[model samples]
Target chain A: MEIKLSAPITKEKLAALKAGDRVLLTGTVYTARDQAHKRICEALTRGEDAPFELEGAIIYYVGPSPAPPGRPIGSAGPTTSYRMDPYAPALLDLGQAAMIGKGPRNEEVKKAIVRNGAVYFAAIGGAAALISKSVKSAEVIAYDDLGAEAVRRLEVEDMPLIVAIDSRGCDLYERD
Target chain B: MRELDVKEITEAIAGLSKETNVSLSEDVKSRICMMRMKETDEGAKSILETIEKNIKIAGEEDIPLCQDTGLACVFLDIGQDVHLVGGSLKDAVNEGVRRGYTEGYLRKSVVTDPIRRGNTGDNTPARIIYDIVPGDKVTITFAPKGFGSENMSRIAMLPPAAGEEGVKDFIVDAVRQAGGNPCPPVVVGVGIGSTFDGAALMAKKALLLPLDEHHEDPYYAAMEDELLERINKLGVGPQGFGGDTTAIGLRINTAPTHIAGMPVAVNINCHVARHKSVTL
Candidate 1:
């Protein structure tokens, strides 16, 4: 059945999502993808403090479109999730609670979610425009020179997403 | 001599690009409807419902259907009789792509270099292919080919005796292997012809067919039917979430092969198939 969602969701709420639950979310979320991810991973490698606090934050796996005249964001949707697999284990260790994207994550990412009290949310893959409308405000947070791939802070309202993987490692995708 | 200026071509290209990116093609729309009716797995059917709703919201809101927007791929068939007047056809198309990608606020996915991996600022220099056809007309088709579907496309050359059954095995196996990665209930495009590259092109071109339309050749149509049945049986299902409709549609385009060998290629497209054509 269709259900609305909110950000900063607890592990219990996230674990509630089965395959068919439709969700609409709200609250603060951060954008990350290939460029931003690489930067974050590199920062971790260098023992340098990264741009944003990783403690209990939502990291959206997206690189959004440029905002038009008066809107807050352009077509904003989830990118493929697997590309972030290598870096996710690190973030989970840092206490990031939620992830948003499409496709499946690797086994390590899933296990980390369980270990760190985190979850993965799935925004509709191609429904960028619809998803962007939920963003009330947005601003660049780091990696300014990386262009669209830079990390950004977004204050969203009723941003819709469903749980893809929960803390218990119950995946919503195929295994074999 | 008329100059084929960037102004009109740019507008048309931008418009075509926007229309294609936001809305599902008519053929795709109708085929999904058919699938919704025929799908056996409840979970897959529910996913299909969300997809249908997503399309509706996209059109009504005039938002992009998917955020990826895809790498710009332009196919041009210019007739021998007409000459471009003002701007070069390539520039006009590129300019159109730039305008379409920018104004629409679509993502700039085209990278400038393969190894270095630099973004091209604007999604320019579309992957262009031109064919000289008879008469004085120009037709342009844009397949905003998304990465999820593209990464899974494959090509192979088989012995002539491997024949149709071999083709079926490869197609089904590819889907089974791809699992949930390429997005499910995929549109499978099969191209059978000479050489490896030709097979690939044939497969990509096969994606141009109307979803519900079938090949005129009964033998080929039967193969398409058999392939579809086998694919569904593989149980890859919708979104690989487990269902009956592993594939939403299948189209095959064949060409005469060399006497010595037969080549085959299969290109898998996710359910979000976005493509369109314009005649100028």
Candidate 2:
């Protein structure tokens, strides 16, 4: 059965999810890819504030196409998650609740998710045009120079995802 | 010699760049439809359905099928009998890429430098490969390549003694290791018998071939069929959900190699294999 999740997911809510659970996520999620993740990590190392609130927030690893004249965003979908492995633990410690991306995560990230009460979700890769239907609005919130790689605040409605790794570190990518 | 204006070349490239991004070629679409019919895993089947729907949406709405939009990879078959007028060919290609990325609203994914990475703002300096052939016409093939699958591609150099078995094992192993990362159901492009770089180039070039097309050599064509069977048996399935259709197609290209060494390369392209061609 599919679960309905809203962003700023609570610890209790996240704890209930398990690997292979389908989810329809609604509410706000922040977009960040390689460059933005690097900057966020750098800021954390320097004891500076991150570009957005970390508590209960979910970061989507994506670099979206430019919005057409009338659309809110164009063909926004998950990028490979392994690229962000280096910086994911730090964000998890800062109270980041979940992540939406595709592909396998490293061992370190799996450990971080388990220890920090976080979950990892997979949005279907290459289903960008279909996924974009859920995005209601988007505006760049940081690193505008990064172009598509910039961090953007996206308000998504009923975005489909699958729980690839739960807070307990039950990973869908791993064979039983 | 036939005179072809650089402006015409630029315009053709620009038009192709946009066209390739938003639509899947008929051959690719047919392959996907066939896979969809055979896929059994519920998750994999649903993913394929979404992909099919996305293709339609992208076409009707005139939006890129994927946000990556990819780096412009232009392959040119320039005829020796054709003379270029106006600006240099390279500049015209880059201009075409710049205008296409901007006007088409495709994502600009290229960076100014590899290490000190900064967005070039305009996707410029397309990866252009040229082959001079005997004709009066110039044929350009534009393939927009996303990096997700590109990152999973690999090359290996084996001793000549490793032979056919070694090549098959290597290709299968590469696909196994890539798992869900390259976005299966993928198209596996294999290049055999060239230097390191040449093998890699051939692997990429192989992707430009239609999915239904087989290698010219019967030997290589049979190898492709065998490799595809082994890869699908790995059960990576669509997006690695474990299904029957792990790979939609496999294309192999071969070149004469140095007797001392056997070089092979694997280039994996996601199901959204985007390419278009125009002759000017």
Candidate 3:
């Protein structure tokens, strides 16, 4: 069923989701991919504040192409989530409530999702141009040196997503 | 010797880079359209529709079909009778990539070093493969390879006794392991025999062939059809949601191998499979 979700997703909302549910996420979400995830996790290990507020926030794993003329972002779509597996649990511990990416997550990531009351959503992997249309605005928030891998705060409207993993640790990637 | 200017090569590559990323080839487009018509799963059907719409928007707006514009992979069939003039061939190719990525607004995905991991700022130092042929023309085939599928590729060294069944098993297993990560309805390229590196290179080279082109050898051609059918039956479906079309095409290239070993490699390409060619 189609459902609308906003950022700072709460435990109640995550609990209501299950694997395979269609979702339209609308709100402020942060973007980071492999390099940025490594940096964020390293910073947290040093007891430093994350570049953006992590509590109840949703992070979209993407490194978009440079925006074309008059566009907020260009060809934004989810990257594979498994690359972020090593660092995801740490972000979950920081109360990051949701993640938007594609592919299967590791067992540790799935367990962390269940324990932390978070959800994992999959955006259509190669449908970048279509997905970019929902992004209303985007601004680099940190790690600008990483170029496309930089952390960006994005405001999105009805971004298409599927709940690939739920708070209860159910996963859509698992064959029935 | 016939001489060709490096500038001409650069310009051709630049144009090809932009064109391939924004537009799907007729062969690839028609295959996807045919698969979409036969797809029965609702989720998989919707994903295919989104892919079609994305292709249209990217073409109309001159934007990349996907955010990961990919590493520029250039394959050159250089004629032995032709001389490259004006500049270093490598520099000219990189220059073309830089211009294409910048002017085309494609993402710069290259890193200066594997460990240090600094962005190149411009996508440069394309993965270039050159082959000397018996002609006066230099044929440049540009395939922008995204890592999502590249990372899923696998290489195996099997004993000669393992034979054809072993090769088929390896290719199917690799695709199953890749699942949704490479993006579903992927195009698979299989390289058999040769040394490890040569097999891997052939696997990548196989991707440059048109989707409709079958293997020249009838035996391998039938093997390709069998492999494609088995992959589709995996039910990984479109975007791994489960459906009928898991892979659109599978191509196999083979060469003589060492008496002691048979090396095989599998290279996966996402459905976008963006590539273009120019003969200079």
A41-105 per-residue lDDT for model 1 (tens digits) = 89889999878888878999888877767888777878878889999999989878888888778
Displacement of the residue B118 alpha carbon in candidate 1, Å = 2.0
When superposed on Cα atoms, how far off is each prediction in RMSD? 2.5, 0.9, 1.0
Task: Output the number of the lDDT-best candidate.
Answer: 3
What TM-score against the true fold does each predicted structure earn? 0.91, 0.99, 0.98
CAPRI classification of candidate 1: medium
Which residue runs of candidate 2 sit more than 4 Å off their true CA positions? none
* DockQ per model, Cα: 0.52, 0.83, 0.83
| Chain A TM-score of each candidate structure, as shown | 0.91, 0.98, 0.98
lDDT of 1 by residue, B164-244 (tens): 778778888888887777767789999988677888887888887888788889999988888988998887777666788
TM-score, prediction 1: 0.91
lDDT of candidate 3 over B202-251, digit per residue (tens): 99988878889899999999999999999999999988878888998889
DockQ of 3: 0.83
Q: Indicate the docking level reached by candidate 2.
A: high
Instruction: Please compute the TM-score of chain B alone for each predicted structure, in the order given.
Output: 0.95, 0.98, 0.98
Deviation from native of the Cα of residue A160 in model 3, angstroms: 0.7
- If the candidates were sorted by their lDDT against the true structure, best first, what order would they fall in? 3, 2, 1
